[model samples]
Target: MTDQAPAPAINADRLWSRHMEMARIGPVEETGNCRLALTPEDVEARNLFARWCREAGMELTSDRAANMFARREGRDPARAAVAAGSHLDTQPHGGRFDGVSGVLTALEVIETLKDAGIETDAPLMVVNWTNEEGVRFGPGILGSAWFAGRIDDATLDDIRATDGARFAEEAAASGWRGTATPADLPMEAFFELHIEQGPMLEQAGADIGVVDAVQGLCWLDVAVTGMDAHAGTTPLPARRDALLAAAAMLVGINDMGRASGEDARVSVGRLKTATEGPSTVVGASEFVIDIRHPDQAMIAHLQEECRRVCAEVARRYGCGVEVSQRFAIPPTAFDGGCVAAVEAAAQALQLPYRRMASGALHDAANVAAHAPTSMIFVPCRDGISHNVAEYASREHLAAGANVLLRAMLAKAG
Candidate 1:
């Protein structure tokens, strides 16, 4: 390890204060927040974030994808910027800190450096990625994907949210769009500090989490078809029961998830039946299976297993089944050197931390495709997120920010 200059400390109180203030934008009865991507609430959050960065004396820029960056230049004009931050958008029922915490922590890093008037070898950038939640219009991480060149102009423009509002129109409606292209985001390194959104850290009583990689994710939409029949007249032995088959499939899906061990994650997030009347036997069923695993091959294998299970269950129930995998992203591994910085930062602070992998998809995963990237995780209450019950302590939030500050400074220097 190289001897490095000590980074300036951040103000915990100020950080917490800013967090509460930001939470007020879309508060849900005082417990959580809700700011859907590219909506009016999203625009409100972006404007405030830009104002805060401006107050910190940072120059702001937006990309064609509408991703925001607050830049603090370095002594060497030729070096790539060292970046930190995450998205500011939230799920419809998201907690205050899910994505917002990462954005604020990065801003705190920039503010701490600016307050100290410190200059480094490379420019520093604090980014606020757009639309990470896809709650409005998604496949989430659209902003980061576009900035990384994984998405093209036509596709990005064609995206529509639940309200049928085009992504291009909504992004432009925010008025934060920039003329810069993906070519402008070639950073030397990027870091993100976010809440774990899981119980692991809290369960282990760790103060910080050094994230090494993110799990691959796949979305499966399953449907079962059967003949509709009258509940009074259909014989139990003769009738094909779609609902019963669907219940069996759900149990089978849970079993498949368990076969992958503790590292794998799977859940059925949504389900719908075709019939409305109680007397009529359900004719069809549709549901979505969400899965995450560190290994790409394992995730694929599990998908296949799910398909096989669905087929067998359908045959037993005398029904037809179809499974459609609509979306997938392979697992992402962070840069080892960048991850080391996070670990070192935690060690230097004497904060209890565990080296772990992120189960949730993050903007950092997308940034990793373009530059060296890593992440910091703090504990949230009960490992719950994207809901009104999500919670994290002020002290835990500050600890993660301080860790982010040191790691980011090392990269910037």
Candidate 2:
């Protein structure tokens, strides 16, 4: 590996200014941002990013999923590009920094390189993955999944949002979708810079987080059924309330989650009780379960336990229960080569860092399957994310950007 020039310094002020400007596209009342996938806001955001990439002399290459790849050519055309970035789509009540920070940080790296007139042996790439939040259409990481061929075009196109809009229609209307397929180019290495989105780094007083792995995640849709009856006439002993049975199951799930220790996580984020009347017993109840752990075996064991427990509770209440595993993502360990690049960068930059596993899923996790991949996480205020309150100090963000710049340089060289 050779150095064409000293790693260019990132302009902190310029980077922050760009973030604030992008925030204006999906501006919310007081603070949070909302740019659900393929919405007008999302399209506008993509345009702005593309505009910036053009200004930096990077060419746009996108896929049908609208996964934007901004490339800065290198000296050698045969070598694949070293890539970095995160998705830009935000949650309905997302903060300004969650995924957007990663995108802008990569832009900063490109701008810095442009200013320095430095080029690497292999090309550099910044990607803006689409629909990572899965708020509009799930499961999340759609673009990266397609890029990796983990999900085929037919399945991705067939997906529909809660509002009944097909992903195909939305992608077609966005006008950003391109002719290039995800497999058109090979990625030599990929790195992402993001807010830790958790309290660990802040609490540890670390300057950066070198993510080594991501926890496994499972999503289950549970349904409980029982005969509806008049609440006033149905005595407790005679009642076969679905909601009651579900309540017990939730408690049991929580207990199971705790039984495995703090690393295990389980939550019932959504629940609906159908029989709604002052004197009506709930006949049917449905809810979604989200569970995460580092151990796949433990996750599988917990899944079976959930089914067995729910079935038992339903039997006791004279109800029927069904549990379906809607989605499952096994734990992912980042590539050692990619991880070493990040570590060396942090050490060279004199930024304190911790090697840890990410509790949340990220696009890096999906891309890791195809290329050597790693992540750099800066601290966010109080670990808040996916909300308007999400924040990371500008100083910290700049530090992360420098680390990213150095890491990408290390890989691309």
Candidate 3:
């Protein structure tokens, strides 16, 4: 048997510079990024990634949903490819490294492997799953969802961005329309490198995190309708205000999640009131509820509680209530063998590491439905994410990339 080769070290300066350059594309003053999916900024970012991949001499392919893949061919063409990558889209005030790091780090891994003259038994692919942020279209992991067959082309056509641009139009405008479907390529294993997005790794003094599972996410649009009236003329007790009902439901949501346990999280991130006038009581109000828990059954239980509380709040305000599910991604656990591969790689590098659960949903969760998959996390400062202040240190970035390199090598070899 041939002896296994040692993985090459990642260049911290190169990685840091790549991250900074990408950050400049959708630069925001508050250190938050703003590259919405299928926007001009998103186009620029995708072009830049394509340029980098081409310079590395990797074969590039785009799926029908515009998911990008840059491949490094292996000695054997018959084996399923080992893949690593993440998304390029960002939240309204997103940070530089959230999804970007994973894609860039995967590229770095390819470069490092090539430089080391290492050839694997299976081809290596760096993936850029489209709309992983779901910032523009209201659904995260759109590309991965399509890849997993959880979503279809008809549904993709119906999705519209915040600006009312249909997904099909934006996809065509961005020049990413491809014929490759998800079922066309099957992966041997998949890996993603991402920032912890939470404070777990930092608090534990670990450099890398081997993610065990991603919490299940439930998103709902709650609407309350009531009679509009003069704010001053209607007595507080007599007024049937939709906004009041929404407020009550929001408070209840917080209480329920907190009481559920440490793993539970509930957020009313977006809210809208129909009556904008100061003197008019709100006749209708709609808000989005985002709840997550590591346990699917527990999340189901929490959803029922949320529904009951919302109904009661509406009754108290003499309003009609409606709840529509926007998106629901069940709790996903990483493949045990893939987890073992990541742990073994981290141990080989002597990096301080811990096994953790992901609080935020990721493309890996969607892809896991179709293939063996896992993720590695580096610490972000203070565990802050989805904001301009999200950050990961250069040292941690290098360490995480190195771990990714080893893990990819293990799977591909």
Candidate 4:
């Protein structure tokens, strides 16, 4: 590796302008975007991205799942491409930089190389994995999951969006879907440049983040049952309120998470009761516990602890409780060589950075199963994401793109 930085560095102004241009297609409140997968807004955004790729002299291809790939030819045509990018689809209330940064910054890298007339030993690619937000569809990261062989073709095709649109039908309508398979476009390495989506780098005053792992996640569905009775007539000592038991379970689960350490995350974002009337005692309550940890073993332990706490809390309230796992994703450790490339890029660029684990799941997690993959994170303002106020400054984004460019070059060479 050379101590000197590459010539024709990423253009901060151009990158920021591209972000603003894409944000216009699905504009929301102020700076937010809402380009749900396969929707009209998303199609427009894809068309725009395709146009930009064509303008840059990159050949664009896509898969049956509607995942987009733009390739820049290299000296060795047979070598697998070094790929980079993230999703283009946004959450219903996502900000401009969440997934957009990954895609645009990748394009910026390719553009910088093209302008400098530099070619590598392996081809370079920019990808836009579909349905990553999964706001309309049932599951997120649908595109990468299919590409990684985790989901079968029939199952992926049959999935219906919340608005009743079939996945296959929508994909066909988007006009970007094709027959390209993972085998057809092999990857030597993949890099995703994304906003931190959390406040860590910003709080630490860092310029870049070298992402090494993604946390595992588990969801437990819990139910508490009790006999309904009149709120006024039921004696406090004789009452078996399911709501009360569930409330106690929530507190216990939170405390368990807190005690587990800083890496542990447990949350009950949704809850429901059978009875709503103030005069009637609730007979049934249901809630989901979201548990997460960087270690798979710790996730299992936390899940079991949550179940035990719910059962004990139910017994204390004279209620019957049931806890079942909804789903779980094992923690993902990125490719070591790719991770080292990112770290080395930071060091070479003289950017203050930290090696960190991603708290939220990303398309990079799925791609890791199929290829040597890692990620670069630019700090967002206040660590906020999935909201209209999500933000990353031009300097930080350009910094991340430079790291991505360097890392991709290292791998491609």
Models 1 onward score TM values of 0.93, 0.90, 0.86, 0.97
Quick one: best TM-score, which candidate?
A: 4
Best by lDDT: 4
Model 2 per-residue lDDT tens digits across residues 157-255: 889987899888888889877878756768899998889999999999898999988889898999999989997777998988999999999999898
Model 3 lDDT tens row, 168-251: 878888887677777667799999999999898999999999998999989888999998999888899888899988999999
> Once model 2 is optimally superposed onto the true structure by TM-score, how far is the C-alpha of residue 395 displaced, in angstroms?
1.5
lDDT (CA) for every model shown? Answer: 0.88, 0.90, 0.89, 0.93
Cα deviation of 167 in candidate 4 (Å)? 1.5
lDDT of 4 by residue, 203-307 (tens): 899999999999999999999999899988889989989999999999999998999998999999999999999988889999999999989999999999998
Q: Model 3: which ten-residue window has the lowest total lDDT?
A: 1-10
Task: Show pairs that collide, candidate 1.
Answer: 198-383
Q: List the residue pairs that clash in candidate 2.
A: none
lDDT ranking, best first: 4, 2, 3, 1
RMSD of each: 2.2, 2.7, 3.2, 1.4
Q: Rank the candidates by TM-score, best first.
A: 4, 1, 2, 3
Q: Which regions of candidate 1 deviate over 4 angstroms?
A: 1-4
Clashing pairs in 4: 198-383, 199-383
